[model samples]
Target: MPFTQAFINESFRFKTLLPLNLMRSSVENSSILGNFIPKNTRVLANIWAVHNDPKVWLNPQIFNPNRFLTDDGKEVIKIDALIPFSTGKEILKTIPLVKQFK
Candidate 1:
């Protein structure tokens, strides 16, 4: 399933609020603020680097939509891996309508 769908399913299954509360909790609990990301971190998030890491992805530089596609041809996107907002002090106020996966 797509990350958003999975999040929704899990949230529904657990009976939790959407978007804000979860995001807040994740930020609060993240190690990015401490060790993973440097202190005084002003570097623009290397989203490209994260998305294209050969160690994490099968084809680092290739634009393979199949990388995100599921066995059923629906796109199986991972949310945590593709956070457009990146980790920062600013919070995302809007929740996007994410594509669904089987």
Candidate 2:
């Protein structure tokens, strides 16, 4: 069962159905990872970039469902970089509904 969940997450991360999540905007001036941003700047989280980043993931391009499984292989590891639905209040609200449907 855990491996099943891991496989699903890995598939979602690798496939990246949307490629890019909904665009986001800065509510006020902000700085991110040494990058500065003015208020109301439109920003998009490149789903593909984050999912495929070598720094965040090992062999990101390779389809490896085992990556999400723990060494014991009994539990699925939660990967922060895997954000197929993006993240925020809206997504948090929708998650339960999605789970129910799924």
Candidate 3:
């Protein structure tokens, strides 16, 4: 069941439904990735870019559910970068709802 869930997760990450996150305004001046972000600046995050980032996932372009599996292959490892539907409170409750299990 865990591997199946991992596969579903990888599938979502492989072809993200919504690649762009909701636009957010900076409440205050902040620096991100060494760049200056002024207050009131509209900022949008790219979920696809993060999902495919080399720094975050090894061989990210390849469809590998094992990336979300534990070493023993008995449990699914939660990955913070697998956000196909952008980021929000709902994103925190991400869980595959498939009913079949072997």
The backbone clash count of each candidate, in order, is 0, 0, 0
Q: Candidate 1 — which residues are off by over 4 angstroms?
A: 1-43, 89-102
Model 2 agreement with the true structure over 1-102: per-residue lDDT tens digits:
998999999998899887776887878887654467799998665667667778677999899999999999999998767777665635423332223222
Evaluation by TM-score, superior candidate among 2 and 3: 2
Better of 1 and 3 by TM-score: 3
Sort all candidates by TM-score, best to worst: 2, 3, 1
Runs of candidate 2 with Cα error greater than 4 angstroms are 89-102
In terms of lDDT, model 3 sits at 0.73
Error of 3 at 75 (Å): 0.8
- Clashing residue pairs in candidate 3 (N, C-alpha, C atoms within 3 angstroms): none
Minimal lDDT window, size 10, model 1:
93-102
Model 3 TM-score (2 dp): 0.77
Give the true-structure RMSD of model 3. Answer: 9.4
Best candidate per TM-score, number? 2
Model 3 scores worst on lDDT over the 10 consecutive residues at: 93-102
Cand. 2 TM to true fold: 0.81
